[model samples]
Target: MTHYFSWLKNPDNRLKLLILAFVITLFPFVAVSFFAFPTTDDYCHTLAVKEMGYWGYQVHYWKTWSGRYIGTLISATQPLAYDSYLGYKLAPIVLILLYVHASLKFAGAITGDKLAKWQTYLLAFLLVFVLIAELPVVSGYFYWYTGYYYTVADIGTLYLLAYLFRNYSKLSSRNIVVLALGIILLVGMNEYTLVWLVVLSGALFFFGSVVTRKLQVKYLVLSAVALVFGVLSVTAPGNAARAESGLYPTPLKYNLLFSIKNSLAWQIHNFAKIAPALCVLALVLIPIACQLFKNKGDFKFLRAHPALSILVFVGCLYLSYFPSYWSIAEPPNLRGQCVITFWTLIGWTYNVFVLTFWALEKGYMKPVEPGKPVAWVVGLYFFFLFTGNFNYRSAWSDLLTGRAARFNKEMHERTALVLNTREEQVYVPKLKNVPYTILIVNDETDPAWASVEVNNGCAEWFFKKKFFYK
Candidate 1:
C-alpha cells in the first residue's frame, strides 16, 4: 500500500491517472451525443433562417422575438441549417472540447507559472467535470442546438477573461481592440451573460480602485463597453414586444424579491445535490491550495476581506438570477439555470480553496499532503458519480441499456416518414423510448396546447406539412 501511494505521488503519474478518469467520466456523455436530436426551437429557427435567408432571419428575430443578435445568428446556422445529421452529432463533442480548452486557458492565466502544467490541467479538468456533471439540465446546455449557443458564449467569456487577466497590465492597442470586440459579441449573445460580465467588470473596478487604490483604465473601458452594448440589447423593440406577449407576468417588486430568494434557495439546493462530488473537490483542492500558498506570496487581499468577498460572491449569484426573473417575470428556465449552476460551482470551489488556504495560514489546520486522504476521497467521488449522481448515471444507463440507440432509431424513422409523406397533414405516433439525457417534449394530441401548436408549426414549416401527434 505504501509503495502504491508512492507511485501515485509522482506528478506525472497523477496527471495520467486524472486524465484517464476524465476520459472515463466523459465517455458516456459523449457517446450518447450520437443519439441527440434537435427539439422544438431547433426546427423553428432553422426553418426561419431558410425562409428569410441568414442575415434576413437575424433582422426578423431582432424585430420580433429576441435581442440576442449573436445567439439568433448562431441558432440560425446550426447543423440542421445545412441538413447535416453528422454535424449535429459532432456539435456536443466540439462544445465539450472548447469548454476544456477555455478552462485550461483560464486556469493557466490565473495560476501563472506558480503551478506546474499538470497542476493547472488538474484544476481545469476538475472545474470542467463539476460544471458538466452538475448542470441542472444537460440537454438544454449541451445537446439542444438552439440552447448551446449560450454555452458557447459563456466559454467565450471565459477565454476573454483569461486574456484580460493575463494581459491587463500590459495590454497592447491590438489586444484592447480584441477585448472590445469580444465584449461586443458576448453581450449580443445573451442577456444573462451580458449582465454577468457587467457585474463582474463592476466588481473588478471597485476592488481595484477603491480597495487597492490602483485604477485600471482597461477595466473602466471594458465596463463602459459592456454597459453600452447591454443598454442597446435591452432596449431593442423586440424586448417590449416579448414583454407584451405576457410571457413574463410577474410584477417588478415580486420579481426583485423572488430573484434574491430563489438565488439563495437554488444555490443551497445545488450544493446538496452535488454534495459528495463537492466533498471530493474540496479534498482535491486542499493540496493545490497548500501549493499555491507556499509558492505564491500570501494571497493577502483574498484573505484580508473575507466578509466582503462573501458578500461579493453572494451578490454575483443574486445578479445571475435577477436578469432572468426581470426579463421573464420568473426564475430562469432550465437552459438559463445552466449559467446559475456554472457560477455557483465555480464560486463554491474558489471559496473552498480560499478558506483552506486561510486556515492553513492561520495555523487552524495542518498543511495538506496529497496522499491517502486525496486518494480515498477520489475513490468515493467516482463511486458516487457513477452510481449516485443522476446525471452521469442516467447517461451511462441510456448508453448501456440501448435507450439512446432506440431513441436515435425512432427519430431517424420519424424524419424519414416526414420527408416521404405526401399529405398536407400527417399523423405521427409519440416516441416510445425517450432518453433521459435528451430533451424530449412529447407532442400533445390537442393542437390547442401552445407546445403542440408550436411544435406542429415548426414541423410544418420544416417539412412542408402539418404534423399531428396521437
Candidate 2:
C-alpha cells in the first residue's frame, strides 16, 4: 500500500496524466462526433469567406459581420471551411488541444517548477475538467465555427498572458509576432473577452504603478495596443447592428436588475450542476495546497498594492459579464453563454488560488497528507464521481451513435433527391438533432434570386451540388 501511494507521486505519474488528459479531451469529440454538420452561422461564414480576401474584408463586412465578427483574421479560415467539410469539422478538436497546451504552460508559469511530476499531471487533468465538465451537451461551443472561434481565442488569451510574464524576463522575436497576431484576432474574435481585456489591462496600468520593476516600455505598448483593439471591438459596426436588432431592449434600470439576477443565477447553476466535480476539485486542491510552501511572514507586496490587487480580483469576477448587461435583457443563446461560462470558471478559480496562496503565506493550515489507503481511495472516489455525474454517457452515445446514423440516412436521401429531380429542387427534411439552414436559392436555371428560405444552402452543401446560390 505504501509502495502504491509513493509510486503515485513519482516520475511515471506524468505519463499517466498525459494519457488521462488525452482521454478527457477525446471524450467530448467522440461524444459529439456526429455533430460536425454545418449550421446557420457556419454556412454563412463559409460562404462569406469569398467576399473579402487578404486584401479587403470590409467590402462584405456588413454581410457576414451580422452574426460573428472574425475581423481581418477571417481570411485564415479560407480553404478549411470552403474547400472541405472534414477540415472545418476537425478544427475545434485541434484548437482544443492547443488550448490545453497553452494552459499547461500557464500553470507551469504559476507553479515555477515547484510541482512534482504527479502534481503537474493532476493539474492538467483538473484543467481539462474545468473546461469540459460543465459544457452543455451537443453545444455549438465545441463543434460549430462561431462558438469554437471564441473558445480557442480565450485560451489564446492565456497564451498571451504566459508570453507577457515570461517575455518581461527575456524578450523573443517570435513571441512579438505571435502577440501581434493574437491582439489583432481579439479585436474581432471575441468581444466579451475584449471588454474584460480592456478592464484588466487598465488595472495592470495601475498595478505597474506599484511594481516599479514592471514599468517597462514594452508593457506600456502592449497595454495600449490591447486597449485600442478593445475599443475597436466594442465600437464595431457589426456590434451596433446586433444591438439594434435586440429582441427585448429594456430600460437601463431593468437591464441592471437583469444582469444582477442572471449573474447569481448562472453562477449558482454552474456550481450546483458540477457539485460532484467541485468535491473532486476540493480533494485534489487540498493536497496541492499542502505541498505548496507555508510562509509565516506577511506579503509586503500585497500590502503595498492592496487596492490594485482588489481591483484586478474584482475585475476578473465581473468584467467578462459586464458586457452582457449592455446588450438586450433577454438571455443569451447557449453558444453566446460559452464566453461567460469559461471566463467565470477562470475568474472564480483565480480568486480561490489567490486566497489559498495568501493563507499559505500566512500559514493558515498544516499540510494534509493522506495515508496510502486513504490516498488510493481519494483517487478512485474522484474518478468514480467525475464519470458518474459529469460524463453524460447517454448523451454521448445518443449523439455519436444515434444521431450519426440519422445524418448518414439523411445524406443518402438528399443525394437521391438531387439525382431524381429534373427541376433542380428537392425536399430535405429539417433535422431535429441539429440546426441546418435551408438553401434559399438552389435552382441553377433560374438566375433570378428566389425567396430566402430558413434552411438555406443545406441541401447544396450536403450534396456538394454547387447550385446557383447556396
Task: Identify the candidate with maximal TM-score.
Answer: 1
**Where does candidate 2 clash, by residue pair?**
437-455, 437-456, 438-455, 438-456, 438-457, 439-455, 439-456, 439-457
TM-score of each: 0.89, 0.76
TM-score of 1: 0.89
**lDDT of model number 1:** 0.75
Query: What 10-residue stretch in candidate 1 is worst by lDDT?
Result: 443-452
Candidate 1 positional error at 197, Å: 0.6
- Where is model 1 more than 4 Å wrong at Cα? 1-3, 168-174, 248-276, 297-304, 353-367, 441-457
Q: Write the per-residue lDDT of candidate 1 for residues 327-443, one digit (tens) a residue.
A: 665667778778767766666666776677678777888877878666676867766666767788888899999988998888788888878888877777677777777664444
Q: 383 in model 1: Cα distance from truth in Å?
A: 2.7
Model 2: per-residue Cα lDDT over 399-460, one tens digit each: 54565446535544544666676765555444333221111112432211111343344335
RMSD of each: 3.2, 6.4
